[model samples]
Target: MIERWSRDQVLALAPDAASQKAAAGVSAPAKWLVTGVTGAVVWGECKGSGAKPYRACVDLSEPAYKCSCPSRKFPCKHALGLLLLWSADGAPPVEEPVDWVGEWLDQRRERAARQEAREKAKAEAEPTEKAEKVTDERRARQRAERVEAGLADLERWLRDQIAHGIADARRTGLRDWDELAKRLIDAQAPGVSSAVAGLSRVLRHEDWPARLLAEYGLIHLLAVGYRRSAELPADLAETIRSRVGFSTPKEAVLARPPVRDHWQVVATRDEERDRLVSRRVWLHGRATGRPALVLSFAPVGQVLDASLVLGTTLDADLAFYPGAAPLRALVAERHAPATPIQAPPHGIRVAEVPGLIADVLARDPWTESWPLILTDVVPARSGDAWHLTDHHPKEENAVPLLPSAAPPWNLAAVSGGHPVTVAAEWTPDGLRLLTTWDEYGRVVTL
Candidate 1:
C-alpha cells in the first residue's frame, strides 16, 4: 500500500500561499468529477468553468505533478487539490489506472528506460583515449583562434570608441553595446560578451566616465592577457582563459584531487535574468578556513539543485577549478548528509576584509566580489544610510552596507540593537548582507 500524506504535508508542497488557498477551494468532492488512486499514482478530473473537466495526476513515488490546466506554475491548483483530496481520503482506491493516467505512466517509464540504457551504453563503451585527446586538442585550438580574432576586433573597436570621444559613446543607448555583445558571443567569447553587456550599467552611474574608463582598461587588459597567455604563469594563464570564456568539463574537474573538509554552507542567493535563474551558494571549510562558491542554474519555473541548505555543514570533498585564486568548486563527493549549524564555521573581523579583497584581486583582478563572514557587528542607521558598526564598545570602526541592499530591517530586528554575525558579499560598492546569526546563535536569512 502507498503510504498516505497528511493534509499539512500536501499543502506544504504549494509554490505559494495563493496556490495553497486555491487548492483548498478546489479540494471539495463537489469540485472533482472523479478521483481515484492506484498503486503509486493518483488521478482526478476537476470541474472547471469550461465545458470539459481538467485532468490532473500525481506520481506519488516522485511526488511529480501533471495537470491539463492553463497554468505555468508547477503543481498547478488542480494537481495540488487532487493531492489534498487524497490526503483527506477523498480519492478511493481503484484496481486499475484510468486510460489517460496509464498512458502518462507508460510514457514516463519509457523515457526512464531509454535514459538508463543510454547511460549504461556510454559507461560500457570502449575507450579511444588517444583519438579523443587529438579531437579535443583540435577543437581547443580552433576555439582559441576564434577568440583571438574576436579580441583583436574588440581592441580595435575600443580604440575607435576613445578616438571618437567617450561622451559620444555615452550618448548611445544600451542596445548599441548589446549588438557588439552579440558579435562577441557569436565569436565564442561569451565571457567577454557579458563584460561588454555590463558597460550599460556603468553608463547609468553619476561618475560614468571614470567607471567606464576603468572598465575599458580592464577589458583591454583581458584582451592582452589572452594574447600573451603563453608568457604568463600556468595558473594565471588558466585564469585569463577562463575569464575569456573557456570552460573545464565536469568530468575533468571531478577527476582532480579533492579537498576534504567540513564545509559549512553559509548562505545562498538567487538571481533571475532573461528567464534564467542562477543560484550562488557560499561555503567555508571549518578546518582549512578556505571559502568556496558553488553555482547552480535552471530555467525560470524549473527547480534548481537544493541539496546545499543554508546554515548546514557537510563532510564533503570539493574539487576546485584551476585559477590563481581558486574559490569556485564542485562538491565532488559527500561523506554524509548535511547537518544543521547555528553559525558560520569561521568569521573574520570587519577590518580584515580590505586585505583579503586586495589579496584576491591581486591574483584574479576580474573577480566581482568575495564572500565574508563578519563577527560582532550590529546594523546601524545613519540618517538615510546603513552600516555595520563594531559591537565592541572600544572599537569605533564600521563598514558601510551596499546602497542597493533592501533596508536591513530584518537584520536590525534579529539583532535587537545588539551584536550579530553577518555573512555578506564584499564588492567595491559595499557589503551586501546575505545571512546573519542572531544573539541566540540562530541563523537568519537577510
Candidate 2:
C-alpha cells in the first residue's frame, strides 16, 4: 500500500524558494502530458517549451527524485510538481510505470544491491583477519605507552612553569609551546596536542595569566584522568580515553544499537583548520528530544558530504560513540530522504541552556561546546556587542553572541526587534548563531 505524503511535505523537498514557487506554477493538471502512480512510485511527463516533454519520477520509499530537466537543484521543479500532483490525488493509479521510470528504478536497485554486496563481503571477511587485528592492538598498546610517557613529561613541565611563575613562561616564547605540541603529536595524542595548541590563542587575551592558568588546570586534569582511567567508571574511562586522543571506530559505533527517530537537520557549519575542512551537522530528534552531532572531514578545496541539508528532517537510525555524554553519532541507517522540517523538534529557554551544558560537562568535562535551539529570543545590541535576550516579560535571560562573528545584520533585519527561534552553538567564548526561523517559518542560515 502506498503512503501518501502531504502537499507541504512534498514542497518541503524544494531546495530553495525559487524552486518552490516554480514547482507550484507547474503543478496544474493541464501542465502534464501524462501522470501515473504505480505502487509507491509517482511519475509524469510535463509539457515544456522544448520539443521533448520533461520526465519526472519520485521513489516514495527513499523519497528520491529524478527529473529530465536542466535545473541543477535536487528535486527539480518538474519533480516537485509531480509530487504535488500526486499528493493532491491528481495522478491516476496505474499497473506499471513507463519505460523511462522502469529503467531508472532498475538502475537504482542495481546500485543498492552492489553496495550491499560490498558491505556483506567486508563483514564476512572480518573474522578471518585475526592477524591484522592483533597487529593493530599491539600498535595501539605501544602508542598508549608513548602517550603515558608524554603526559608524564607534560605534567612535570606544567609544574615547572608554576614553580618559576607565569612571567618566566611568558619570556620562554611560543616556540617552547610549539615544541611541546610537536611532542604530543609524535606520541599520537592529537586531542591533547590540539588542547596544547589552543593555549597559544589564549596568550592574546588581556588576562592571559589567569586564562592560561585555567587552561593549564584543565590539561592537568586530563592527564590525571587518563592516568586513573582504569579506576574510573566505564563511561568515564571512555570519556577520558577519547579526551586523550583515542577514537572509537565508526564500525564499532554502528555495531551498537541504533536510536531511531525523526532527526531534524537543524544546522551545518564548515571549518578549516590545518589544511583540513571539517563539517559539523547538528540534529535534534523529535521523539527523543535529544541533540546529536554528526561530523565529516575532507581536505581543503574538496567537497564535503552534502547529504544532510539544513532544515530537513531525516527518518533515520543514529548510533552514538561510547562516552558519558554521547553527542557525536554516526548515521547507521536512513529510512528516507531528507524532508523539510516545519519547526524545531524542541527548544529551550535561554536561562535553561546553562543547566544543560552543566549536565553535559558533569558527564564529559572536556566538552568544548553544545548545540542548542533557543525559543523566543530576540537579537539585541548593547554598545558594540550583541546578545540574544528573552522576549518574555518575566525572564531576564540574555546570552552574548560570539564577539568574533560578524555583526548579524541579517538576523537583526529578519527579527526586526521581534522574538525568533534560533539554533546556535554555545562555546566557552560565546554563542555562534547557525540557523534561525523567521515569522514566515522560513529558514535563515547565519
Candidate 3:
C-alpha cells in the first residue's frame, strides 16, 4: 500500500521521512512483540545499507522516526526501504549485512519481557500485603503522630493564606501551593496537598469566590475524613488514608481487577505552567463504557506519551497509577488501527454566537474562550462590537479557549478562505485551535 502511494503524498502525511522509515522498519519483521497499549508495536527488519549497518524504529502512534544512520528524513532511507519491503506481496529479502537489526529487536523483547515480569510479580504480591495487618501498636502510633504534624502544618498554611487575603494569596500562586504541598508531603499529609493544589487552579480563574468556597469545603471534607478514618468503612477509610499521604505499593493497584475495554480517546489537553507540563488524557470506555480521565505530568520539555489521539479508539488494558487519586493510566494495547478523528457532533453557527458560547460552556463551563472556524468570514457589527461571522454555519464547532488578560478575541484565515476564531487571551503564543481539517491552527499573531 505504501509503495503504491506517491512518495510526496506519504512524506506529506508524515513529515518525518526518517521517522516513517524507522517505523516501517519496525513493521518489516514478522516477529510481533506486544508492547504496552499506548499504541506500542515492535518488530524486526533487515535492510541493505551497502557499507554500514541499519536499524530503526517507526512508532505509528507518534509517527516518530529514529535511525542509527544520519539521514535527516526522520526515519531515513533504511526505514522507508524496510517499510516498502513489508507492504509488498512477496518482498525480496536483502542480504543480511550485520546484527544491528537483530540486536535492536532483542533489546525490545528483553525490555518487554522485564516489564511483563514486573507486572506479574506486582499482581502476585498485592493480596499478600493487604492480608497482613499492622500488628505493631507502636508503628500505628508513629504513623498517627506523623499525620497529626502534617495536618497542623496544613492548618497553619490555611490561616496564613486567610491572613494575607485573597489578593495576596493570588500573588503567592502555585509556588505557594507547591511549597505547602511539599510541607504536607514531609508531614505525611499528601491528601491535603492534593486538595490545596486543586484549589490553586481555582485561584487563577476569574471567579475566585465560588472556587474558594468549594476548595474550603474540600478541605473540611479532608479534615473530617482523616479524623474519622478509624470508624469509617474499610474502602472509605482507605481512600481517606491514601489521600492523606499514606503510601500504597504499586502492586496493590495492579492487584485490583483491571478496567479492560476499547477506550476512545475523547480529548487530549496539556498545560505547562511553572516548570510542570501536565497532560490530561480522557478516555471513554467502550465496554463498561465509563469516562475515565488520566493525568501525566513531566518537567519542562519532557514528553509524556503522545500515541493517544482524540476521537481514536483503542482496545487497551489500562493500569492506573498508584496514589491517593490514581487518575494516570498506562496503555496496554492498540486494539484497532487508528483512523481519522470524527468531527464534534454539536455544530457552531456563525450567526448564533451566543448559542455557540452556551454549547461550549455546557461542555466546558470553566472555559474562558470558545474556538470557531468560519468557512466564509464577513465582518458583522453587534451594537458597537465587531465580530467575524462564519458563512457555512454547520461546518464548524466551538472549542474551549483559556482566559487571558487582554482582548480575549482572535481570528485567522485557513486555506479555503475560512477564518478561525481563537480566544485572543490564551497566551500571546496564539490560539490552540482543535481542527481535524488542519494540522496547524490559523494563527493570528498580534
Candidate of highest TM-score: 2
How many Å off is the CA of 419 in candidate 3? 16
The CA lDDT of each predicted structure is: 0.90, 0.90, 0.53
Model 2 pairs whose backbones collide: none
RMSD of 3: 21.6
Encode model 1's per-residue lDDT on 1-446: one tens digit a residue: 78999999998899999999999999999999999999999999999989999999999998888899999988899999999999999999999988999999999999999999998877666356566888989998898788999999999989987887788666684777888899899889999999999888886679989998898889999999999999999999999989989998889889988999999999999999999999999998988989999999999999999999988999999999989999999999999999988554568887787788899999999999899888888998898899888888788778899987888999999989877788899887889999988666678898
Question: Could you tell me every candidate's TM-score relative to the true structure?
Answer: 0.69, 0.70, 0.42
lDDT value, candidate 3, whole model: 0.53
lDDT of 3 by residue, 53-164 (tens): 4545444444444566665654465555444443442233334423554564467669879999999999999777665544445677887888887786666666676676
Residue range 1-446, candidate 2, lDDT tens digits: 77888989988899999999999999999999899999889999999989999999998988888888888899899999999998999999999899999999999999999999999998888876877899989998999899999999889989988887887556664877889899999988889988988787777788888889988998999998988888899988998889889998888999999999999998999999889999999999988989999999999999999899888999999999998999999999999988999865569989998799899889987888999999888988899999998998787789999998999999999899888889999998899999998787878999
| lDDT of model 2 at position 50 | 96
Question: How many clashes show up per model?
Answer: 0, 0, 18
**Residue 170 in model 3: shift from native, Å?**
7.9
Q: Which residue pairs clash in candidate 1?
A: none
Q: What does candidate 2 score on TM?
A: 0.70
